[model samples]
Target: MYRYRITAEIRRDLERIELLRERFDNRGTLPRRWLGRLRRDLEAESVAASTMMEGVRVTVEEVRRLLAGDTPPTVDELSASLVLGYRDAMSYVLRRADEPSFAWHAELVKAIHDRVMGGAFGLDAGRFRTIPVFISDGSDGEPVYTPPAEDLVPDLVDGLAEYLESSKELPAPVVAAFAHVRLAGIHPFKDGNGRTARVVAALAMYRGGYRAPEFTSLEEWWGGHRGEYHTAFDCLGKRWKDSSDVTPFVAAHVAAQRIQADALSLRLATQREIWTAIEDRVE
Candidate 1:
């Protein structure tokens, strides 16, 4: 029962992400050295930020050490699984960006969930939720929002996949945003729903060639604004199942895309200047 109401504001934000995406469409806009700088610690930072949004008490330092094969100080299994699993799954999304073999499907989303929470929570990963759950306001208070029933999750997820496939008329960013909200509203999985929703959004963009030459994580941006993020979710009302407009969530997400795109552009430009100066000194 959800449809993206693309306002003029959303249009502008999609345009913003598209411009940078066009710059990197060729995938060689940046020199190999610059690419190395961008890729150097991007994945770790992105994964760390994403896990943090999932309530993991982990930091980029801990993640970097863990990646370096060092034991993190006081890193528990939950934190470890979230950090590593999301990193692996994020790698898949970025890898599939270049590989044409990956296709949009419901099962593809499930596979990403598997990488996200499979081993972390036994039997709950990769499968749709069989039991009901509640979205919360970080309180033991009454449920904030309840998603569709388990029986409805499969159909709802499939509808989203079908939207991705059939909505060729829509801009990739817009479709990606819709995918993010739709699956999130469905709350398909028992756990990892939030992470999976964000990943699915990334998948839609990366697969659609929506990337800038520099590295940036939409998750990182969202993680930094958890209050605003939840506030947007709260707009769906106690009964998200009722037909309610999602303009607030869509508009805010698209606006954040512009903020991130601008940030990356500035970062890349500064890096370019530094790289040029280094080249001149080297010669």
Candidate 2:
């Protein structure tokens, strides 16, 4: 469906992600107490960061509290609902990370959008758009990119599904990065396309074995460096353009993966240090 040249940086970053993944996975024998703590912490962080990127107004504190079953912040109703929906969707992705039978398809894409826009306004959950949509600058409201026609949405998605199945020889991170850029470029749904695209990227990383999917926080990295993130997508333009070389976008994605892997390794070590301090004090 799309074509890209894998540059040397892409190869190097992909290799780094895999190496860091192996180093971190060896710590899987972690004490259950710490593992559960880290899992809960990372889940809330992922929800907060991912939703915030999509313009959700809630804070990380509010989201963390919400995940703990507390009442939401006194923000707008949509903010709370959007974050909740995103949390559910992120949880679903993490759950499916290790499934050998999992494959990308149109129905699965619809389902993710459903989770993301379940209670939002002026949008149909889990369905492709029937009209044109333009993504614009948040500041000026000038259109930055125009998606393909509504009539082409279905076929575009079908092409992506086919590509995901056939690209087995490509590096998983590269495949996942392309999947994300294509999904967002297709802009298939009326809403939740961005959130859904990010989740799809996470699914690709998990499927590719880049790192333990449970704890990798690529969203966290993306949210922090959104300028680079948006620029990466913009560098490719939409799928139909003559300048749609995906090498830069894939390179940026692999860079984010490398950052997340290193961050996870350091966090894991820090958690262990804290646990040891507690053990020493108790003894």
Q: Which tens-of-lDDT digit does each residue in 54-167 have in candidate 1?
A: 788888889887766675768986778777788778777777667656567888888899988835557478888888777776777678888888788888787778878777
All-Cα superposition RMSD per candidate: 2.3, 2.0
- Candidates in order have lDDT scores of 0.75, 0.79
Residue range 1-283, candidate 2, lDDT tens digits: 5568888888888778777767877765877887888887787777788888888877778888887878564766777778888878867777876777887789888888888885454668888999888888789988888888899898889889888878878788888889888898888988789899988887777766655644245778888888998998866563345237777788888788787778777888888999989989999
Among residues 3 or more apart in sequence or in different chains, the pairs in candidate 2 whose N, CA or C atoms overlap within 3 Å are none
How high is the lDDT of residue 242 in model 1?
38
Candidate 1 all-Cα RMSD:
2.3
What TM-score does structure 2 among the candidates reach?
0.92
TM-score of every candidate: 0.90, 0.92
- Clashing residue pairs for model 1: none
Model 2 regions more than 4 Å off: 97-101, 119-122, 214-216, 238-243
* Most TM-score-accurate candidate: 2
